[model samples]
Target: MKIELRDISISYGKRAVMQSISLTAMPGDVTAIVGPNGCGKTSVLRAIAGLAGYSGQLLFDGRALDRPPKKSNRSLVSYVAQDSAGRSSLTVLEVVLLGRLATLGLRVTEVDKHVVCEVLAELGILHLAQRFLVELSGGQRQLVFIAQALARNPAALLLDEPTSALDIYHQLHVLEVVRRTTQKRGLATVIVLHDLNAAIRYADQVAVLREGHMLACGKPEEIVRPDVVGPVFRVEMVSLPGAGNYPTLVATGPVHGSQGAASPT
Candidate 1:
């Protein structure tokens, strides 16, 4: 499935948070939303997931759903929140099995158990299936939640700051799984990222947002330049080639001005 957001805007009472934002996530690819804090990146994800109210068009596979998508349309998308690992007493396997609730009636059959185990195995957490959610570390819990989302078998996936609490190793590990699964399943995946380097390295396309509007959108390496990074993030970031020729973003320092402007090098 494909996701298209056209002229989208959001507000809370009288305060505006996003304006005229638009982007697209095509099946078999990863589309990332990158921006500084309070730039409406998370808000965009919520709007797409039909958890938040917004104005403008949100089309899934070329069809627009009524605002806050109906129950029928909800199953077409799976959302992984920034802090998806809630403090539940449920076991890892049970939490993951919850993803199949849309298709389950009373009990989990052998096939459902197989699917849950398969997803956990794919995420390299099958061994932890018997562990309680509250007993796992933050990274492990994050991976388990991701497994749950994948188990849903949705055509589109929305992730909000998925790597915020993860260590560097698991950060790469999770993104790698997301990219591989997105391609293998032909799923339209959209993620909100704060790390510019991760966006360039993992995403096929990147959309930059600033304040309340979209600053730019295109291929990550093409759009994540010094010009775009410096202004949107207010940091002196220079992109350099990393291992295997992947681009790496390094923040030299903060921009020195009351307005957080970058000094010309």
Candidate 2:
């Protein structure tokens, strides 16, 4: 399913956070949303997940959806939030199985169990299935949650800071797995990332948000350069040639002088 957000504006009472913004995510592609703190990145994910109210349209496969996802529609949209706090006695397998918790009835079907195991294996976390969520490391737990989302066999996968608390190794692992899964499953994936490099490496498209407004949206290589990224984050990005055709961005320092204070137009 393709996700299209047309002229979306979000607000609480009189306080408007987002205004007349539109972005699209095609199936078999990963779209990354990057912005500074309090820029409504999470809000955009929520709107698409049908958890938040908005003024504009959120369409799936060219049909405007006016309600939250229903099981009967055969449309599954999985959202993995940042504060996953899996402080429970549930084992990794059990927790991942709960991805279909909303759809399961009296008895668990073999197909559901099969999908759960398949996703775990794909994430390289099948060995940790017997381990308790509370007993695992931060990176392990992150993978477990990702497995949980994929287990739902979703058409669109929404993730919020999936690599926020991980080390460099785990960060790369999670992003790589996410990118691989998106392509393999032909899923429309929307991720909110704080790391620009991760966006450049994994995202097929990038949406740059600032204070609830999208400054730009397009290919990561074109939109993530120093000229475009500098004013949005107010940082000086020193670029270097990296692996493949991607440029490795290094933040030298904060933007200073009169131009430094200027915001992206």
Candidate 3:
């Protein structure tokens, strides 16, 4: 499925956050939203999930959607928020199984259980299936939540700061899993990333937003350059060749003459 946002704008009361933000997330590709703090990156995802109010058009497969798709059409999209908090004492398997709740009726079917286990294994969290959510680490819980989202088998997946608290190893592991799953499932995957390098490495397309306004949108290589990234991040980025001829960014210092201001005007 293809998800398109045309001239979308969002506001909280009278304060506008996102203005004329537009992008298309296509199936079998990962679209990364990169920006500075308080830039409404997460708000954009929430609007897409139908959790936030917005104006302009939201189209799915060329058809307009008035709101978040109804429950019956939920298989079309699944969202994973930044907070992985779980107050309940549910087991890992049970938590992941919640992804299938849209299809579940009076009882749990073997098919649901199978899908849960499959997603857990795919995320390398199968061993934690019987474990309780409260007993797991933050990173582990993040993985479980991702597995839960995957279990839904949605055509589009939206993630918010998915690797925030993860160590380097787990960060790569999770992004790799997400990218692989996105490709394998042909899902339209949109992720909000603070790490420019991660977005460059895993995303097929990149959209840069600053203060709720879109700066640019294109292929990763097109948008991850020094010129495009430096101003948005306020860092002087240098590129060095890496594996498969990919460019890696190394920050030398703050942008010239900015004097380390917290934010640019």
Candidate 4:
């Protein structure tokens, strides 16, 4: 799937969130959206997921979508949101089964079970199949939701801060799995990441947004330069010495004369 957003603008009541925001995520590639807090990163994902109404166009492989995707749609784009965890008694297996509900008959079929199991195993969470959602930690629930999304077999995967609750090991593991899956399944993967280094490591392309506007879009290395990072986040991004061929950036401190907090978008 190839997702294209053209001049999208989103607002809530009387408040505008994003304006003329455009992005493209291609199949077999990962596009990571990065910026400071409240920069409309999540809004962009919501618009592309058709969960939020926007002023402009959202296209999937040249086909326009003007409405939220129905649960019955088999080829629906999968979205793993930031606040995905819920207080529910549903076991991990049961929740994942919902992904195949559109194609499921009255009873759960072997194929559906197989697909659920496959995704759980891939996420290394097969042991969590019988665990209730409320019993798991935030990070564990995050992983479960990711498995559920994968079980849907979507052409496009939208992940909003997927690694926010995870530890260093799981963060690296999940992203590696996402990259491998994106390439192997030829799926378009768009992820919102706060960790600049992680975005650079996992994403083939990077899109930087600030105050509801897109500032840059290109290879991760090019987009994360000091010039771009410093102005957007108001940070002094410094490249360390002997950081190998690929530079590693660290925000040493706030830009000398920048403001306190970035205004909400």
Candidate 5:
């Protein structure tokens, strides 16, 4: 499935957090939204997931998304929020089973239970299935939440800082699972990542947002240069050659220094 956001603008009261943003998430690709703290990356994902009100056209699989919270569309797109709220009461297995609720017409069957268990096991959280959400660590809770989202078998996955509270090992683990699952399932995944290196490593396409606008969007190699990154981050970035791999972006100087902007190659 392909997601198209045309001229999307989202506002809170009189303040517009995201303005006239447009982008696409094609199937079997990991598209990342990255920017500074208040750049509205989460708002964009929320709007696309139909959790926030916005003025724009959101199309899924070439069809306009139904505004009334239809089960079809809800099941098609699964959203994993950054905050872990209201989930403390539910056990890991119970939370993951909730993902299949949209598909269960009348009664829960053995197959449904099997699928949920498989997802929990696959995410390496089967041992934590019986534990209460509130009792788990931040990283464990994150994995459970992601497992819940995946149990739905969504066509497009929307995640807001999926690895924010995780340690380095778990961070890489989450990214690896997302990348492998999305590729194997041909699912379109849109994630908001704070870590620039993780975005560069996992994202097939990178979208840079600045002050509520999409400054640039393209392949990682094309869109992640010093010129493109420096202005968005307000930092002096110099790309150093990596050992036979993609170049790395180094913060060479202070952000407020009067360095001449490097022209985009």
Candidate 6:
């Protein structure tokens, strides 16, 4: 499935959060949205998931999304928020099983349970299936949330800071799972990430956002550069050779003025 956003704009009350944004996500690829805080990354995902009201086109499989027909849209897309507070009272398995509600239509069958269990296992959260969501750690809760998103078996998966609150090991683990799932199942995945390293390591394409505007979008190698990253992040970056041809970013403190003082842009 191909997901396209054409001139999309979103607002909260009278404040415009995102303005005239356009992007695309192709099947069997992982696209990472990266930016500083409060740059409308989450708003973009919410618009795509039909959770936020917006003006402009959200095209799924070449058709514009309709408001009242959100169920049909939901069937084709899964959204995993940064926080799991949306349905925390439910047990892990129950929360994961909710993904099947759209297709199952209030009927829960053994097959649904089987699918939930298999997804939990696949995400390495099977042991937490019977546990209350409140009892799990942050990383474990994130795993459960991702398991639920995967249970829906949607063509496109949208994630907001999917690795936030996770430890380094779990962060890598979750991103690896996302990468493998997209490749093996041919699913289109769009994730918002704050960590540039993780985005470069996991995503096939990177989209950099600045103040609700997309500054750059391309392969990791093309987009991950000091010239492009410095202005967006408002910090000077020194590129150093890494394990492969890709380079690592080292903060050279902050940009300085001619007077040898920190210059805040």
> How do the residues 158-253 of candidate 2 rate in per-residue lDDT, one tens digit apiece?
999999999999999989999999999999999999999999999999999988898889998888888888778888878899989889898989
Give the whole-model CA lDDT for all candidates, comma-separated. 0.87, 0.88, 0.87, 0.84, 0.85, 0.84
Measured by TM-score, how close is model 4 to the native structure? Answer: 0.90
Candidate 1 local lDDT, 58-138, one digit each (tens) = 998889987657776887889999978778899999999999888887888999999999999887899999999999987
Model 6 TM: 0.90
Clashing pairs in 3: none
Colliding pairs, model 5:
none
Per-residue lDDT over 1-265 for candidate 4, one digit per residue giving the tens place of the 0 to 100 score: 8999999999988889999988889999999999889999999988877788799888889988546655543255888888886667899999999877677898999999999999998777899999999999776787788788888799989999988878888788878888988998898999999988888788999998888898888897778777777678898778754333667788888766754333212
Tell me the tens digit of each residue's lDDT in model 3 across 86-123: 55599999999888988898999999999899889888
* TM-scores for every candidate against the unseen true structure: 0.93, 0.93, 0.92, 0.90, 0.90, 0.90
Worst 10 residues of 1 by lDDT: 256-265
Deviation in angstroms for 184 in model 3? 0.6
Q: Candidate 6 — which residues are off by over 4 angstroms?
A: 85-89, 104-107, 256-265
The residue-level lDDT of candidate 3 at 258 comes to 46
Candidate 6 C-alpha error for residue 238, in Å: 1.1
Q: 1 or 4, which is superior by lDDT?
A: 1
Identify the superior model by lDDT, candidate 2 or candidate 3: 2
Please state the error at residue 12 of candidate 3 in Å. 1.2
Error of 2 at 188 (Å): 0.2
* Clashes, model 6: 0
Overall local distance difference test of candidate 6: 0.84
- Residue 220 displacement in candidate 2 (angstroms): 0.9
